[model samples]
Target: MQITRAQRSAVAERITQLERSFYGRGPSNVKVSVSQDVPVSLVVLSIDSLTAADSVLSARGHREAVIRHHEALHDVTRADFINAVEDVVGSQVHAYLAQVHPDTGHAVRVFIFADSGDSRELDSLDDRDD
Candidate 1:
């Protein structure tokens, strides 16, 4: 299943807005894509140029601290993130995986949608026009 440009833009904007509202800084770049790497299709959201404060911590040899902080923040806001995505995709998320690299100021959020037994090869969604 190919994702529409509007859907991608909406998802990216929602994530950026959430980051800015909660973290006081939004990612400089956001890319949303659908993947078919698993039994169920997945939504992959990649964030780039996150807050510079994280880089500062990494430079000061506090990378672990930054990672921990980000983990805690993700834990606290997982529901909101999932909800934002669900609202856009109209599907319940079965799992959400998030990771942040403090040194690079990049993050990835992988969402696995609940399988309805109609999985489609969506890895090419990013390559096609909706």
Candidate 2:
């Protein structure tokens, strides 16, 4: 499925809210870039980089809950959805780094890069790479 920028913005905003609620403050010194690779049917949210504090936050149990919420919002499921959700949450910590530094130009990307019946393209790049 193709998630629009507006949708992504909404997700980002929610993520920010969640981060604020979970932590007294959001991530600092990092950027979160989210992109959906349609050919792979996957959502890729990259962090500009990481800091010591960011690393610490990622090591908490609540972090797993956050990822579950993220995947649940998108209705994603796997053979072991619970484990998958936890993994997503762990991965998402990096994205929150961007929310903490919005002016840094790193935003998270979400997309369905591949589907059960869709073709997969591994090398087609997006504007973020430029």
Candidate 3:
């Protein structure tokens, strides 16, 4: 099934709401888009003005720390997010990806619903020996 613009907007609103509910405030703005290819559907959100001073510090000299921190924040909210999204799109989210650019005060989140065989759960996994 294809995701409609209204549904995408609703998803974006829910994300903003959840951010507020979980973190006490939402970003300055959020934009959401949805796309699909074969076994998985992708929901992407572009967030603005989301860089916390602490997160930026973590980003500057400790890239891994920042990524983990970003993941942890998303992990805490994943249940509500995945449930709401699955309900909206009528699919299960097999994996989720979240990223932040603290220097730019921007963030991106990618929700993958279903296991598309070609995809990588983590880019590092590509280097593992078969």
Question: Which lDDT tens digits does candidate 2 get at residues 2-77?
Answer: 4455544554444454444444443333222444443322243434322344444445534444444434433322
Best by TM-score: 1
lDDT of 1 at 117: 56
Q: What is the lDDT of residue 30 in candidate 2?
A: 24
Models sorted by lDDT, best on top = 1, 3, 2
Ten residues in sequence with the least summed lDDT for candidate 1: 118-127
TM-score of each: 0.79, 0.31, 0.70
Model 1, 36-76: lDDT tens per residue? 55534445454554567777888999999888988998877
lDDT of 3 at 101: 71
TM-score of 1: 0.79
**lDDT of all predictions, in order shown?**
0.74, 0.35, 0.67
* Better candidate number, 2 or 3, judged by TM-score: 3
RMSD of each: 9.1, 13.2, 5.9
Between the candidate structures 1 and 3, which one is better when assessed by lDDT? 1
lDDT of 3 at 117: 43
- In the predicted model 1, the residue pairs found to clash are none
